[model samples]
Target: MLVAMALFALALERLIYWRVTHRRARRALIDAWIQRRDHVSWSALTLREVWTRELLARLRQPLPWLKLLVAVCPLLGLLGTVTGMIQVFDSLSLSDSGQARAMADGVARATLPTLVGMAVAVVGLLFVSRLEQIIRREDQRLHDRMARAVEDAHA
Candidate 1:
C-alpha cells in the first residue's frame, strides 16, 4: 500500500517537474533557434556559461524530496519488520496456536513496509539518473552550439 502510494506520488511529482523544465527548454530553444544560425559571437560565451549554470540549478530542485523519500521509506519499512518480529516472538512465548498464527501474520505484514521502501528507492534512483542524463545532454548541446558559434564568428 505504501509502495503504491509512493509510486503514484512519484509519478505525479516527476510529471510536474518535467513539464516545467520542458516548457522552459522549449521556450529557450525557440528563441535561440535563430541564434542557432547566427555566427557565434563573443556574447555567446557569456550566454552559454550563464544558461548552463541555470540549467544545472533547475535540474537539482527535485532531488531532495526524492532522496528524502528514498531514505525514509526503508527505515519505515524496517520499523514495521521489527514490530512484526516482536509480535511473532510474543506469540511463540504464549504457547497458544491461534496467537502464534496471528503473530506470524503480523510478521508477514511487517515486510510490506520494507517492500515499499525499496520500491521508492528504486523509483527515486531512476528519476535521479534520468535527470542527470538530461542535464548533461542539454549542457553539452549548449556547449557545442557556443563553440560552433564562436568558431563561425572567427571564421
Candidate 2:
C-alpha cells in the first residue's frame, strides 16, 4: 500500500509538472489572468515574484504527501518486524523439535521487510530529489519568461 501510494504520488507530480510547463497551458493561464485584471498597475518584478511563488506552491503540493509516505514506510516495516518477532516467540513456545528452523524463518521474514522498506525509501528520496531539481529549473524558466512578458505588456 505504501509503495502503491508512492508510485501514484510520483506519477501525479510528473503529470502536474508536464501540464504546468506546457507552453500553451502557461500562455493561456497568463492570458486569463490578464483578462481578469488591470495589468497597468502590476510591475514586472511583482508579477514575476507572484507567479514564481504560485507556481512553486503548485509544484510542491504533492511533496508533503510523498515525504509522509517515505516516513511511514520504515514504520510499517518496523511493525512487520514486531509481528515477525511475535511469531518467532510463538513458534519457540510451541515445539521443541523445529524451534531453530521456525526461529530462522521468522528472522528472515522480519529482516526482509526492513530491507525492502529501506530500499523503497531510498528510491523515494531519489525521486523526490529529482522532482525538486525539475521544479527549480522550471521555476527559474517560468520567472524569466513571466518577467519578460510583464515588461512587454507594460511597455
Candidate 3:
C-alpha cells in the first residue's frame, strides 16, 4: 500500500510538471500576469519577481511530501523485516521438525519487503530528479517570458 501511494505521488508529480511546462500553460501564466499588471501598486519588474517566486513555490509545494514518502519506504521495510524475524523465532520455538524450512521461509519474507521498499525509493528518486530538471528549465523559461512581457508593456 505504501509503495502504491509513493508511485501514485510520483505519477502525480510528473503530471504536474507536464502541465506546468506546456507551452499553452506557460503562455496563460504570462497572460495572467499581464492582466494583473495595472491593478497592483508594484512596478512591473517587482511584480514579475514576486510572481516568479510564487510560481516556483507553488510548483515545489508537493515535493517535500513526496520526499517524505520516499524516505519512509525503507523504514517500513525495516519494520517488516523485524516482524518477519519475530515470526521466525516464534516458529523456531514451536516447531522442531520443519525448523529449517520455516526459518528459510521467514528469512525470504523478511528480505522481500526491504527489496521492494528500496526499489520503490529508487524509482521515486528518478522521478524527483526529472521533476527537478523540469522545474529548473521552467524557471528559466518563466523568467524570460516575464521579462519579454514586461518589456512589451513598457513599450
Candidate 4:
C-alpha cells in the first residue's frame, strides 16, 4: 500500500514537471527559479536537471524500508521455527500421538508467517535494486548536463 502510494506520488511529480516544462512560460519560470537562489534553488538548469532530480529522489526513497524488511524476514522465520518446536513438545506430552506428527503440523503452521515475511523482503529487494540503478543513471545524467551547462557558462 505504501509502495503504491509512493509510486503514485512519483508519477504525479513527473506529470507536473512535464506540464510545466512544456509551457511557453518556461523561460520566465526558470529565470525565477534561478534568481531566487537563496539556498535551495539551482541557479539555472535544463529540463534534464529537473528530470534527473525527480528520478534520483524517487530512487532513494524505498531503500531504507527495503533493507529493514529484509532484516525482519529471518527473525520472523526463526520465531516461527521456535513456536513450531514448542508445539511439537506439547504434542510429545501425549502418549497416543507421536512427536513427529506434532512437529510436522507445527512446522507447517509456522511456515506461513516465514513465507509472508520472506515474500515481502524479496519484493522489497527486487524493487530497491532496480531503483538503485535508475537513481545512479539519473545522477549521471544530471552530472553530464551540469558539465555541459558549466562549459556553456565559461564560453
Better of 1 and 2 by lDDT: 2
> What does the lDDT come to for candidate 3?
0.75
Winner by lDDT between candidate 4 and candidate 3: 3
The residue-by-residue lDDT of candidate 3 on 1-155, one tens digit each, is: 65648666666865766685655656777988777646345586676777777777767767787777778888887888888888888878887776677789889988888887887778777777777787899899898887678678878
Of candidates 4 and 1, the better by TM-score: 1
lDDT of 2 by residue, 18-62 (tens): 675655656765665445445546584476467667757767778
- The prediction achieving the highest lDDT against the true structure is 3
TM-score rank, highest first?
3, 2, 1, 4
Instruction: Write one digit per residue (lDDT tens) for candidate 1, span 50-111.
Output: 66677666766666766666677677778877877777777677775667567667778768
**All candidates: TM-score:** 0.67, 0.74, 0.79, 0.52
Supply the global lDDT for candidate 1: 0.66
Clashing pairs in 2: none
> How far in Å is the alpha carbon of 34 misplaced in model 3?
4.8
lDDT of 2 at 125: 74
lDDT computed for candidate 2? 0.70
Candidate 4 clash pair list: none
Full-model lDDT for every candidate: 0.66, 0.70, 0.75, 0.56
Model 3 segments more than 4 A misplaced: 13-17, 20-25, 33-42, 149-155
Worst 10 residues of 4 by lDDT: 22-31
Residues forming the 10-long window of minimal summed lDDT in candidate 2 = 33-42
For candidate 1, the 10 contiguous residues with the lowest summed lDDT are 30-39
